[model samples]
Target: MAGVLIGLALLAFWLFSLFDVITAPEEEVRNVPKALWVLIVVLIPLLGGLIWMLRGRPKVVRDPWPVPPGPGMPKGPDDDPDFLRDLDRRMRGED
Candidate 1:
Protein backbone atom coordinates (compact mmCIF):
# COMPACT_ATOMS: atom_id res chain seq x y z
CA MET A 1 0.00 0.00 0.00
CA ALA A 2 1.02 3.64 0.36
CA GLY A 3 3.06 2.92 3.49
CA VAL A 4 5.08 0.17 1.84
CA LEU A 5 5.74 2.33 -1.20
CA ILE A 6 6.87 5.22 0.99
CA GLY A 7 9.25 2.99 2.94
CA LEU A 8 10.82 1.66 -0.24
CA ALA A 9 11.14 5.16 -1.63
CA LEU A 10 12.91 6.38 1.46
CA LEU A 11 15.16 3.34 1.46
CA ALA A 12 16.07 3.88 -2.17
CA PHE A 13 16.82 7.53 -1.50
CA TRP A 14 18.98 6.62 1.47
CA LEU A 15 20.93 4.08 -0.57
CA PHE A 16 21.50 6.62 -3.32
CA SER A 17 22.84 9.14 -0.83
CA LEU A 18 25.12 6.62 0.83
CA PHE A 19 26.47 5.55 -2.52
CA ASP A 20 27.15 9.14 -3.50
CA VAL A 21 29.13 9.67 -0.29
CA ILE A 22 31.15 6.53 -0.80
CA THR A 23 31.97 7.13 -4.44
CA ALA A 24 32.42 10.89 -4.40
CA PRO A 25 35.81 11.97 -5.73
CA GLU A 26 38.56 11.79 -3.16
CA GLU A 27 39.34 15.49 -3.46
CA GLU A 28 35.70 16.40 -2.92
CA VAL A 29 35.14 14.08 0.02
CA ARG A 30 38.55 14.84 1.39
CA ASN A 31 37.39 18.36 2.18
CA VAL A 32 35.56 16.83 5.11
CA PRO A 33 36.83 13.55 6.36
CA LYS A 34 34.53 10.82 5.05
CA ALA A 35 33.15 9.72 8.42
CA LEU A 36 32.22 13.22 9.56
CA TRP A 37 30.88 14.23 6.19
CA VAL A 38 28.68 11.17 6.05
CA LEU A 39 27.16 12.02 9.42
CA ILE A 40 26.62 15.65 8.46
CA VAL A 41 25.01 14.75 5.16
CA VAL A 42 22.76 12.24 6.83
CA LEU A 43 21.66 14.85 9.33
CA ILE A 44 21.19 17.63 6.78
CA PRO A 45 20.71 15.93 3.46
CA LEU A 46 19.63 18.93 1.40
CA LEU A 47 22.20 21.28 2.88
CA GLY A 48 24.99 18.74 2.40
CA GLY A 49 24.21 18.25 -1.28
CA LEU A 50 23.97 22.00 -1.87
CA ILE A 51 27.25 22.68 -0.10
CA TRP A 52 29.04 19.94 -2.00
CA MET A 53 27.83 21.17 -5.38
CA LEU A 54 28.62 24.81 -4.67
CA ARG A 55 32.11 24.15 -3.36
CA GLY A 56 32.96 21.62 -6.06
CA ARG A 57 31.87 23.78 -8.97
CA PRO A 58 34.78 24.04 -11.36
CA LYS A 59 36.22 27.51 -11.84
CA VAL A 60 36.33 28.78 -15.40
CA VAL A 61 39.01 31.17 -16.59
CA ARG A 62 38.76 33.34 -19.69
CA ASP A 63 42.50 33.12 -20.30
CA PRO A 64 43.94 30.34 -22.46
CA TRP A 65 43.02 26.99 -20.94
CA PRO A 66 46.26 25.16 -20.36
CA VAL A 67 47.31 27.43 -17.48
CA PRO A 68 48.14 31.05 -18.22
CA PRO A 69 51.70 32.31 -18.44
CA GLY A 70 53.39 33.65 -15.32
CA PRO A 71 53.46 37.40 -14.68
CA GLY A 72 56.15 39.25 -16.71
CA MET A 73 56.68 36.19 -18.89
CA PRO A 74 56.13 37.67 -22.32
CA LYS A 75 53.96 35.35 -24.42
CA GLY A 76 55.81 36.19 -27.57
CA PRO A 77 58.79 38.30 -28.59
CA ASP A 78 58.10 41.92 -29.54
CA ASP A 79 59.78 41.02 -32.79
CA ASP A 80 57.95 37.74 -33.24
CA PRO A 81 57.82 36.26 -36.76
CA ASP A 82 54.45 37.84 -37.61
CA PHE A 83 55.75 41.26 -36.57
CA LEU A 84 58.97 40.77 -38.51
CA ARG A 85 57.01 39.63 -41.55
CA ASP A 86 54.85 42.73 -41.41
CA LEU A 87 57.93 44.85 -40.92
CA ASP A 88 59.60 43.27 -43.96
CA ARG A 89 56.47 43.80 -46.02
CA ARG A 90 56.36 47.44 -44.97
CA MET A 91 60.05 47.96 -45.79
CA ARG A 92 59.68 46.33 -49.25
CA GLY A 93 56.68 48.52 -50.05
CA GLU A 94 58.50 51.64 -48.83
CA ASP A 95 61.60 50.85 -50.89
Candidate 2:
Protein backbone atom coordinates (compact mmCIF):
# COMPACT_ATOMS: atom_id res chain seq x y z
CA MET A 1 0.00 0.00 0.00
CA ALA A 2 2.76 2.44 0.93
CA GLY A 3 4.76 1.54 -2.18
CA VAL A 4 1.77 2.18 -4.40
CA LEU A 5 1.17 5.54 -2.73
CA ILE A 6 4.81 6.51 -3.21
CA GLY A 7 4.71 5.55 -6.87
CA LEU A 8 1.56 7.60 -7.44
CA ALA A 9 3.10 10.60 -5.69
CA LEU A 10 6.23 10.37 -7.88
CA LEU A 11 4.08 10.07 -10.99
CA ALA A 12 2.16 13.24 -10.04
CA PHE A 13 5.39 15.08 -9.31
CA TRP A 14 6.90 13.97 -12.63
CA LEU A 15 3.85 15.09 -14.58
CA PHE A 16 3.77 18.44 -12.82
CA SER A 17 7.49 19.04 -13.46
CA LEU A 18 7.20 17.97 -17.10
CA PHE A 19 4.35 20.39 -17.75
CA ASP A 20 6.20 23.22 -16.02
CA VAL A 21 9.32 22.64 -18.11
CA ILE A 22 7.37 22.59 -21.38
CA THR A 23 5.29 25.68 -20.62
CA ALA A 24 8.08 27.80 -19.13
CA PRO A 25 9.53 30.48 -21.43
CA GLU A 26 12.76 29.45 -23.19
CA GLU A 27 14.74 32.37 -21.78
CA GLU A 28 13.58 31.68 -18.23
CA VAL A 29 14.82 28.07 -18.02
CA ARG A 30 18.30 27.49 -16.50
CA ASN A 31 21.13 24.94 -16.85
CA VAL A 32 20.39 22.42 -19.67
CA PRO A 33 18.39 23.47 -22.76
CA LYS A 34 14.58 23.30 -22.76
CA ALA A 35 14.47 20.42 -25.26
CA LEU A 36 16.84 18.31 -23.16
CA TRP A 37 14.85 19.11 -20.05
CA VAL A 38 11.70 17.85 -21.77
CA LEU A 39 13.40 14.60 -22.76
CA ILE A 40 14.86 14.09 -19.29
CA VAL A 41 11.49 14.62 -17.68
CA VAL A 42 9.80 12.25 -20.14
CA LEU A 43 12.42 9.49 -20.11
CA ILE A 44 13.41 9.30 -16.45
CA PRO A 45 10.26 10.55 -14.67
CA LEU A 46 11.24 10.40 -10.97
CA LEU A 47 14.93 11.18 -11.30
CA GLY A 48 14.30 13.73 -14.01
CA GLY A 49 11.80 15.57 -11.85
CA LEU A 50 14.27 15.59 -8.98
CA ILE A 51 16.99 16.97 -11.25
CA TRP A 52 14.71 19.69 -12.63
CA MET A 53 13.55 20.69 -9.16
CA LEU A 54 17.17 20.95 -8.06
CA ARG A 55 18.91 22.50 -11.11
CA GLY A 56 16.72 23.47 -14.04
CA ARG A 57 14.10 25.75 -12.47
CA PRO A 58 14.22 29.46 -13.29
CA LYS A 59 14.56 32.17 -10.65
CA VAL A 60 11.77 34.72 -10.94
CA VAL A 61 12.90 38.28 -11.66
CA ARG A 62 10.82 41.14 -10.31
CA ASP A 63 10.92 44.74 -11.54
CA PRO A 64 12.00 47.07 -8.73
CA TRP A 65 10.98 50.30 -10.53
CA PRO A 66 7.37 51.43 -10.83
CA VAL A 67 6.01 51.72 -14.37
CA PRO A 68 5.43 55.29 -15.57
CA PRO A 69 2.06 56.34 -16.98
CA GLY A 70 1.79 56.46 -20.76
CA PRO A 71 1.19 59.62 -22.80
CA GLY A 72 -2.13 61.52 -22.33
CA MET A 73 -3.23 59.29 -19.43
CA PRO A 74 -5.58 60.96 -16.91
CA LYS A 75 -6.12 59.84 -13.36
CA GLY A 76 -9.86 60.46 -13.66
CA PRO A 77 -12.42 62.55 -15.61
CA ASP A 78 -12.89 64.87 -12.63
CA ASP A 79 -9.14 65.50 -12.41
CA ASP A 80 -8.67 66.15 -16.16
CA PRO A 81 -9.44 69.80 -17.21
CA ASP A 82 -10.21 68.87 -20.81
CA PHE A 83 -12.54 66.09 -19.68
CA LEU A 84 -14.35 68.39 -17.24
CA ARG A 85 -14.70 71.08 -19.94
CA ASP A 86 -16.13 68.49 -22.32
CA LEU A 87 -18.50 67.33 -19.62
CA ASP A 88 -19.66 70.93 -19.00
CA ARG A 89 -20.24 71.49 -22.73
CA ARG A 90 -22.16 68.24 -22.99
CA MET A 91 -24.31 69.14 -19.99
CA ARG A 92 -25.14 72.55 -21.60
CA GLY A 93 -26.30 70.65 -24.73
CA GLU A 94 -23.45 72.03 -26.88
CA ASP A 95 -21.94 69.59 -29.42
Candidate 3:
Protein backbone atom coordinates (compact mmCIF):
# COMPACT_ATOMS: atom_id res chain seq x y z
CA MET A 1 0.00 0.00 0.00
CA ALA A 2 2.82 2.43 0.82
CA GLY A 3 4.43 1.81 -2.58
CA VAL A 4 1.15 2.38 -4.33
CA LEU A 5 0.67 5.67 -2.55
CA ILE A 6 4.18 6.80 -3.48
CA GLY A 7 3.56 5.93 -7.09
CA LEU A 8 0.34 7.91 -7.10
CA ALA A 9 2.13 10.92 -5.61
CA LEU A 10 4.81 10.78 -8.29
CA LEU A 11 2.23 10.50 -11.02
CA ALA A 12 0.35 13.50 -9.74
CA PHE A 13 3.48 15.58 -9.66
CA TRP A 14 4.39 14.49 -13.16
CA LEU A 15 1.02 15.33 -14.61
CA PHE A 16 1.01 18.73 -12.98
CA SER A 17 4.44 19.53 -14.28
CA LEU A 18 3.62 18.24 -17.71
CA PHE A 19 0.55 20.40 -18.09
CA ASP A 20 2.43 23.47 -16.90
CA VAL A 21 5.42 22.95 -19.23
CA ILE A 22 3.25 22.24 -22.23
CA THR A 23 1.23 25.42 -21.81
CA ALA A 24 3.96 27.76 -20.59
CA PRO A 25 5.07 30.64 -22.84
CA GLU A 26 8.39 30.45 -24.68
CA GLU A 27 9.85 33.71 -23.36
CA GLU A 28 10.00 32.10 -19.90
CA VAL A 29 11.49 28.82 -21.03
CA ARG A 30 14.85 29.97 -19.73
CA ASN A 31 13.46 29.82 -16.22
CA VAL A 32 11.80 26.98 -14.33
CA PRO A 33 8.59 27.07 -16.35
CA LYS A 34 6.97 24.53 -14.04
CA ALA A 35 10.05 22.33 -14.19
CA LEU A 36 9.75 20.90 -17.68
CA TRP A 37 13.05 19.27 -16.82
CA VAL A 38 11.07 16.93 -14.67
CA LEU A 39 10.29 15.04 -17.85
CA ILE A 40 13.99 14.26 -18.16
CA VAL A 41 14.35 12.94 -14.65
CA VAL A 42 15.06 9.21 -14.45
CA LEU A 43 12.92 6.93 -12.18
CA ILE A 44 10.30 9.69 -12.15
CA PRO A 45 6.79 9.20 -13.46
CA LEU A 46 7.03 11.38 -16.59
CA LEU A 47 10.54 10.38 -17.67
CA GLY A 48 9.64 8.45 -20.78
CA GLY A 49 6.30 10.09 -21.53
CA LEU A 50 7.33 13.31 -23.21
CA ILE A 51 6.96 13.36 -26.98
CA TRP A 52 9.44 16.21 -27.26
CA MET A 53 12.20 13.93 -26.01
CA LEU A 54 11.82 11.81 -29.16
CA ARG A 55 10.13 13.94 -31.80
CA GLY A 56 10.96 17.57 -30.96
CA ARG A 57 9.90 20.59 -29.01
CA PRO A 58 7.80 23.10 -30.90
CA LYS A 59 8.65 26.80 -31.10
CA VAL A 60 5.58 27.93 -29.26
CA VAL A 61 6.45 31.55 -29.88
CA ARG A 62 7.58 33.30 -33.08
CA ASP A 63 7.70 30.40 -35.50
CA PRO A 64 10.40 30.75 -38.18
CA TRP A 65 7.79 30.64 -40.93
CA PRO A 66 7.29 33.66 -43.16
CA VAL A 67 4.94 36.45 -42.27
CA PRO A 68 3.16 39.03 -44.49
CA PRO A 69 3.87 42.10 -42.31
CA GLY A 70 6.25 43.18 -45.08
CA PRO A 71 9.05 45.76 -44.81
CA GLY A 72 8.66 49.28 -43.33
CA MET A 73 5.67 48.02 -41.31
CA PRO A 74 5.27 46.97 -37.73
CA LYS A 75 6.37 43.36 -37.16
CA GLY A 76 4.07 42.18 -34.41
CA PRO A 77 0.42 41.23 -33.90
CA ASP A 78 0.06 44.54 -32.07
CA ASP A 79 1.73 46.18 -35.06
CA ASP A 80 -1.02 44.96 -37.37
CA PRO A 81 -3.83 47.14 -35.99
CA ASP A 82 -1.50 50.05 -35.27
CA PHE A 83 -0.03 49.76 -38.75
CA LEU A 84 -3.45 49.90 -40.35
CA ARG A 85 -4.41 52.96 -38.32
CA ASP A 86 -1.03 54.52 -38.92
CA LEU A 87 -1.41 54.00 -42.66
CA ASP A 88 -4.82 55.61 -42.60
CA ARG A 89 -3.49 58.55 -40.61
CA ARG A 90 -0.47 58.87 -42.86
CA MET A 91 -2.61 58.97 -45.98
CA ARG A 92 -4.72 61.70 -44.35
CA GLY A 93 -1.64 63.27 -42.70
CA GLU A 94 -3.48 63.46 -39.38
CA ASP A 95 -2.09 63.24 -35.86
Candidate 4:
Protein backbone atom coordinates (compact mmCIF):
# COMPACT_ATOMS: atom_id res chain seq x y z
CA MET A 1 0.00 0.00 0.00
CA ALA A 2 2.70 2.45 0.95
CA GLY A 3 4.76 1.47 -2.07
CA VAL A 4 1.79 1.98 -4.38
CA LEU A 5 1.10 5.39 -2.98
CA ILE A 6 4.72 6.40 -3.41
CA GLY A 7 4.69 5.09 -6.95
CA LEU A 8 1.56 7.08 -7.80
CA ALA A 9 3.03 10.21 -6.30
CA LEU A 10 6.20 9.80 -8.33
CA LEU A 11 4.15 9.15 -11.44
CA ALA A 12 2.11 12.26 -10.89
CA PHE A 13 5.26 14.28 -10.35
CA TRP A 14 6.79 12.90 -13.54
CA LEU A 15 3.71 13.63 -15.61
CA PHE A 16 3.40 17.15 -14.22
CA SER A 17 7.07 17.86 -14.82
CA LEU A 18 6.86 16.52 -18.36
CA PHE A 19 3.80 18.59 -19.14
CA ASP A 20 5.33 21.71 -17.63
CA VAL A 21 8.49 21.29 -19.68
CA ILE A 22 6.53 20.81 -22.88
CA THR A 23 4.23 23.73 -22.32
CA ALA A 24 6.72 26.26 -20.95
CA PRO A 25 7.66 29.01 -23.37
CA GLU A 26 11.20 28.85 -24.72
CA GLU A 27 12.11 32.24 -23.33
CA GLU A 28 10.78 31.36 -19.88
CA VAL A 29 12.55 28.03 -19.34
CA ARG A 30 15.69 28.70 -17.25
CA ASN A 31 19.14 27.05 -16.95
CA VAL A 32 18.75 24.64 -19.90
CA PRO A 33 17.31 24.52 -23.37
CA LYS A 34 13.67 23.36 -23.27
CA ALA A 35 14.46 20.23 -25.26
CA LEU A 36 17.27 19.28 -22.90
CA TRP A 37 15.06 19.78 -19.90
CA VAL A 38 12.41 17.55 -21.39
CA LEU A 39 14.97 14.86 -22.03
CA ILE A 40 16.33 15.12 -18.51
CA VAL A 41 12.88 14.79 -16.96
CA VAL A 42 11.94 11.86 -19.17
CA LEU A 43 15.14 9.98 -18.47
CA ILE A 44 15.42 10.63 -14.74
CA PRO A 45 11.98 11.40 -13.39
CA LEU A 46 12.46 12.09 -9.66
CA LEU A 47 15.79 13.90 -9.69
CA GLY A 48 15.04 15.71 -12.93
CA GLY A 49 11.69 16.87 -11.64
CA LEU A 50 13.32 18.27 -8.51
CA ILE A 51 15.98 20.05 -10.53
CA TRP A 52 13.43 21.45 -12.94
CA MET A 53 11.23 22.70 -10.13
CA LEU A 54 14.18 24.34 -8.42
CA ARG A 55 16.20 25.69 -11.33
CA GLY A 56 14.41 25.43 -14.67
CA ARG A 57 11.01 26.91 -13.91
CA PRO A 58 10.39 30.49 -14.88
CA LYS A 59 10.99 33.12 -12.24
CA VAL A 60 7.70 34.73 -11.39
CA VAL A 61 7.77 38.46 -10.76
CA ARG A 62 4.72 39.69 -8.90
CA ASP A 63 3.75 43.22 -7.97
CA PRO A 64 2.98 43.65 -4.28
CA TRP A 65 -0.06 45.74 -5.14
CA PRO A 66 -2.17 46.25 -8.22
CA VAL A 67 -0.96 49.04 -10.46
CA PRO A 68 -3.15 52.10 -10.74
CA PRO A 69 -4.15 53.24 -14.20
CA GLY A 70 -1.77 55.65 -15.90
CA PRO A 71 -2.42 59.37 -16.11
CA GLY A 72 -5.49 60.27 -18.20
CA MET A 73 -6.69 56.66 -18.00
CA PRO A 74 -10.08 56.05 -16.42
CA LYS A 75 -10.25 53.35 -13.80
CA GLY A 76 -14.01 53.00 -14.07
CA PRO A 77 -17.09 54.49 -15.72
CA ASP A 78 -17.44 56.99 -12.85
CA ASP A 79 -13.90 58.19 -13.51
CA ASP A 80 -14.45 58.77 -17.24
CA PRO A 81 -15.38 62.33 -18.12
CA ASP A 82 -16.96 61.37 -21.45
CA PHE A 83 -19.10 58.72 -19.76
CA LEU A 84 -20.24 61.17 -17.06
CA ARG A 85 -21.11 63.77 -19.69
CA ASP A 86 -23.11 61.21 -21.67
CA LEU A 87 -24.93 60.11 -18.51
CA ASP A 88 -25.82 63.74 -17.70
CA ARG A 89 -27.11 64.33 -21.20
CA ARG A 90 -29.25 61.18 -21.03
CA MET A 91 -30.71 62.17 -17.67
CA ARG A 92 -31.80 65.56 -19.18
CA GLY A 93 -33.41 63.65 -22.19
CA GLU A 94 -30.97 65.31 -24.64
CA ASP A 95 -30.34 63.41 -27.91
Candidate 5:
Protein backbone atom coordinates (compact mmCIF):
# COMPACT_ATOMS: atom_id res chain seq x y z
CA MET A 1 0.00 0.00 0.00
CA ALA A 2 0.99 3.63 -0.38
CA GLY A 3 1.35 4.10 3.36
CA VAL A 4 3.66 1.09 3.68
CA LEU A 5 5.86 2.34 0.87
CA ILE A 6 6.08 5.78 2.44
CA GLY A 7 6.99 4.28 5.81
CA LEU A 8 9.71 2.17 4.27
CA ALA A 9 11.16 5.17 2.46
CA LEU A 10 11.23 7.18 5.66
CA LEU A 11 12.89 4.31 7.50
CA ALA A 12 15.52 4.02 4.80
CA PHE A 13 16.19 7.75 4.97
CA TRP A 14 16.51 7.59 8.75
CA LEU A 15 18.91 4.67 8.61
CA PHE A 16 21.06 6.35 5.97
CA SER A 17 21.15 9.55 8.01
CA LEU A 18 22.12 7.67 11.16
CA PHE A 19 24.91 5.87 9.37
CA ASP A 20 26.12 9.10 7.84
CA VAL A 21 26.25 10.79 11.24
CA ILE A 22 28.18 7.91 12.78
CA THR A 23 30.69 7.80 9.94
CA ALA A 24 31.18 11.53 9.43
CA PRO A 25 34.60 12.83 10.47
CA GLU A 26 34.66 14.92 13.65
CA GLU A 27 36.14 17.95 11.92
CA GLU A 28 33.55 17.89 9.15
CA VAL A 29 30.45 18.00 11.34
CA ARG A 30 28.94 21.52 11.53
CA ASN A 31 26.42 23.51 13.62
CA VAL A 32 26.99 21.26 16.71
CA PRO A 33 29.35 18.64 18.03
CA LYS A 34 29.40 15.27 16.30
CA ALA A 35 28.11 13.49 19.41
CA LEU A 36 25.24 15.95 19.72
CA TRP A 37 24.33 15.50 16.06
CA VAL A 38 24.29 11.73 16.50
CA LEU A 39 22.02 12.07 19.54
CA ILE A 40 19.69 14.38 17.66
CA VAL A 41 19.41 12.02 14.70
CA VAL A 42 18.85 9.01 16.95
CA LEU A 43 16.21 10.74 19.06
CA ILE A 44 14.25 12.50 16.30
CA PRO A 45 14.78 10.65 13.06
CA LEU A 46 12.94 12.63 10.39
CA LEU A 47 13.49 16.20 11.54
CA GLY A 48 17.01 15.53 12.77
CA GLY A 49 17.95 13.87 9.52
CA LEU A 50 16.62 16.82 7.56
CA ILE A 51 18.46 19.32 9.70
CA TRP A 52 21.70 17.36 9.55
CA MET A 53 21.53 16.99 5.80
CA LEU A 54 20.88 20.69 5.40
CA ARG A 55 23.21 22.14 8.05
CA GLY A 56 25.55 19.60 9.57
CA ARG A 57 26.91 17.88 6.49
CA PRO A 58 30.36 18.95 5.40
CA LYS A 59 30.64 21.42 2.58
CA VAL A 60 32.79 19.42 0.21
CA VAL A 61 34.35 21.37 -2.61
CA ARG A 62 35.60 18.97 -5.22
CA ASP A 63 37.99 20.02 -7.99
CA PRO A 64 36.86 18.97 -11.47
CA TRP A 65 40.47 18.20 -12.43
CA PRO A 66 43.02 16.30 -10.45
CA VAL A 67 45.45 18.57 -8.59
CA PRO A 68 49.03 18.47 -9.75
CA PRO A 69 51.72 17.86 -7.19
CA GLY A 70 53.47 20.91 -5.71
CA PRO A 71 56.79 22.19 -7.00
CA GLY A 72 59.72 19.70 -6.68
CA MET A 73 57.29 16.83 -6.05
CA PRO A 74 57.59 14.97 -9.32
CA LYS A 75 54.84 12.46 -9.85
CA GLY A 76 56.95 10.31 -12.17
CA PRO A 77 60.33 10.21 -13.94
CA ASP A 78 58.76 11.62 -17.09
CA ASP A 79 57.32 14.51 -15.09
CA ASP A 80 60.73 15.56 -13.71
CA PRO A 81 62.35 17.87 -16.23
CA ASP A 82 65.82 17.27 -14.82
CA PHE A 83 65.41 13.52 -15.08
CA LEU A 84 64.18 13.79 -18.65
CA ARG A 85 67.06 16.04 -19.63
CA ASP A 86 69.60 13.67 -18.07
CA LEU A 87 68.01 10.76 -19.83
CA ASP A 88 68.19 12.60 -23.15
CA ARG A 89 71.90 13.37 -22.61
CA ARG A 90 72.67 9.78 -21.70
CA MET A 91 70.83 8.53 -24.78
CA ARG A 92 72.83 10.90 -27.04
CA GLY A 93 76.14 9.75 -25.41
CA GLU A 94 76.84 13.13 -23.77
CA ASP A 95 78.79 13.24 -20.46
Candidate 6:
Protein backbone atom coordinates (compact mmCIF):
# COMPACT_ATOMS: atom_id res chain seq x y z
CA MET A 1 0.00 0.00 0.00
CA ALA A 2 0.97 3.65 -0.42
CA GLY A 3 1.12 4.18 3.32
CA VAL A 4 3.45 1.25 3.85
CA LEU A 5 5.83 2.46 1.13
CA ILE A 6 5.90 5.96 2.64
CA GLY A 7 6.62 4.52 6.07
CA LEU A 8 9.47 2.42 4.73
CA ALA A 9 10.97 5.40 2.92
CA LEU A 10 10.83 7.46 6.09
CA LEU A 11 12.37 4.60 8.03
CA ALA A 12 15.18 4.35 5.52
CA PHE A 13 15.85 8.09 5.65
CA TRP A 14 15.86 7.98 9.44
CA LEU A 15 18.23 5.04 9.53
CA PHE A 16 20.63 6.73 7.10
CA SER A 17 20.57 9.90 9.19
CA LEU A 18 21.17 7.87 12.35
CA PHE A 19 24.15 6.09 10.79
CA ASP A 20 25.59 9.41 9.57
CA VAL A 21 25.35 10.87 13.06
CA ILE A 22 26.95 7.84 14.67
CA THR A 23 29.84 7.79 12.19
CA ALA A 24 30.44 11.51 11.85
CA PRO A 25 33.60 12.84 13.50
CA GLU A 26 32.99 14.30 16.98
CA GLU A 27 34.39 17.73 16.13
CA GLU A 28 32.48 17.98 12.83
CA VAL A 29 29.07 17.57 14.50
CA ARG A 30 27.52 20.92 15.44
CA ASN A 31 24.75 22.14 17.83
CA VAL A 32 24.61 18.85 19.73
CA PRO A 33 27.42 16.43 20.64
CA LYS A 34 27.76 13.12 18.74
CA ALA A 35 26.38 10.91 21.51
CA LEU A 36 23.36 13.14 22.11
CA TRP A 37 22.67 13.33 18.39
CA VAL A 38 22.63 9.53 18.26
CA LEU A 39 20.09 9.48 21.10
CA ILE A 40 17.97 12.09 19.37
CA VAL A 41 18.00 10.20 16.07
CA VAL A 42 17.11 6.91 17.74
CA LEU A 43 14.47 8.28 20.15
CA ILE A 44 12.54 10.45 17.72
CA PRO A 45 13.53 9.22 14.31
CA LEU A 46 11.79 11.51 11.82
CA LEU A 47 12.07 14.80 13.69
CA GLY A 48 15.54 14.07 14.96
CA GLY A 49 16.74 13.16 11.48
CA LEU A 50 15.39 16.47 10.20
CA ILE A 51 17.11 18.34 13.02
CA TRP A 52 20.40 16.57 12.30
CA MET A 53 20.18 17.41 8.63
CA LEU A 54 19.47 21.06 9.42
CA ARG A 55 22.00 21.70 12.19
CA GLY A 56 24.30 18.79 12.99
CA ARG A 57 26.67 18.83 10.01
CA PRO A 58 29.93 20.73 9.74
CA LYS A 59 30.55 23.38 7.08
CA VAL A 60 33.26 22.48 4.59
CA VAL A 61 36.35 24.69 4.40
CA ARG A 62 38.64 24.66 1.39
CA ASP A 63 42.27 25.55 2.06
CA PRO A 64 44.12 28.00 -0.15
CA TRP A 65 47.06 26.67 -2.17
CA PRO A 66 50.45 27.08 -0.50
CA VAL A 67 52.88 29.71 -1.77
CA PRO A 68 55.84 28.46 -3.79
CA PRO A 69 59.42 28.99 -2.65
CA GLY A 70 61.09 32.26 -3.65
CA PRO A 71 63.86 32.76 -6.26
CA GLY A 72 66.50 32.56 -3.47
CA MET A 73 66.23 28.79 -3.76
CA PRO A 74 68.54 27.11 -6.34
CA LYS A 75 67.47 23.91 -8.07
CA GLY A 76 71.08 22.68 -8.26
CA PRO A 77 74.76 23.77 -8.19
CA ASP A 78 74.76 24.11 -12.00
CA ASP A 79 71.82 26.51 -11.89
CA ASP A 80 73.43 28.82 -9.29
CA PRO A 81 75.52 31.65 -10.85
CA ASP A 82 77.91 31.85 -7.91
CA PHE A 83 78.50 28.11 -7.90
CA LEU A 84 79.08 28.11 -11.66
CA ARG A 85 81.62 30.94 -11.32
CA ASP A 86 83.42 29.04 -8.57
CA LEU A 87 83.49 25.92 -10.67
CA ASP A 88 84.96 27.85 -13.63
CA ARG A 89 87.74 29.28 -11.40
CA ARG A 90 88.49 25.81 -10.02
CA MET A 91 88.70 24.41 -13.54
CA ARG A 92 91.25 27.17 -14.45
CA GLY A 93 93.28 26.06 -11.40
CA GLU A 94 92.95 29.45 -9.63
CA ASP A 95 93.23 29.36 -5.77
Best by the lDDT measure: 4
Ten residues in sequence with the least summed lDDT for candidate 3: 48-57
TM-score of 1: 0.40
Model 5 per-residue lDDT at 14 = 98
lDDT of 2 by residue, 17-51 (tens): 99999998899889989999999999999899899
TM-score of each: 0.40, 0.61, 0.35, 0.69, 0.67, 0.62
Best by TM-score: 4
Model 5's alpha-carbon lDDT is 0.95
Poorest 10 consecutive residues by lDDT, candidate 6: 61-70
Judge candidate 1 against the unseen true structure and give its global Cα lDDT, from 0 to 1. 0.64
Give a tens-digit lDDT track for model 4, residues 19-57: 999999999999889999999999999999999999999
In TM-score terms, candidate 3 sits at 0.35
lDDT of 3 by residue, 1-95 (tens): 99999999878766765665566555555433334544543334465344433333334467567757668777775568877888889889797
lDDT tens per residue, model 1, 1-95: 99999878766666666567767655545456766666766787666655544553223437666776688665666636776778888989964
RMSD of 4: 3.2
lDDT string for model 5 (16-89, tens) is: 99999999999988989999999999999999999999999888879867788888799999988999999999
Off by over 4 Å in 2: 62-95
lDDT of 1 at 8: 84
Clash totals, every prediction: 0, 0, 0, 0, 0, 0
Ranking of all candidate structures by their TM-score, best first: 4, 5, 6, 2, 1, 3
Superposed on all Cα atoms, the candidates' RMSDs to the truth, in angstroms, are 9.1, 4.5, 11.9, 3.2, 5.3, 9.0
Model 2 RMSD vs true structure: 4.5
lDDT of each: 0.64, 0.90, 0.57, 0.96, 0.95, 0.89
Q: Candidate 6 lDDT, tens digit per residue, 1-95?
A: 99999999999999899889988889999987899999999999999999999999667787667755468877778879999999999999996
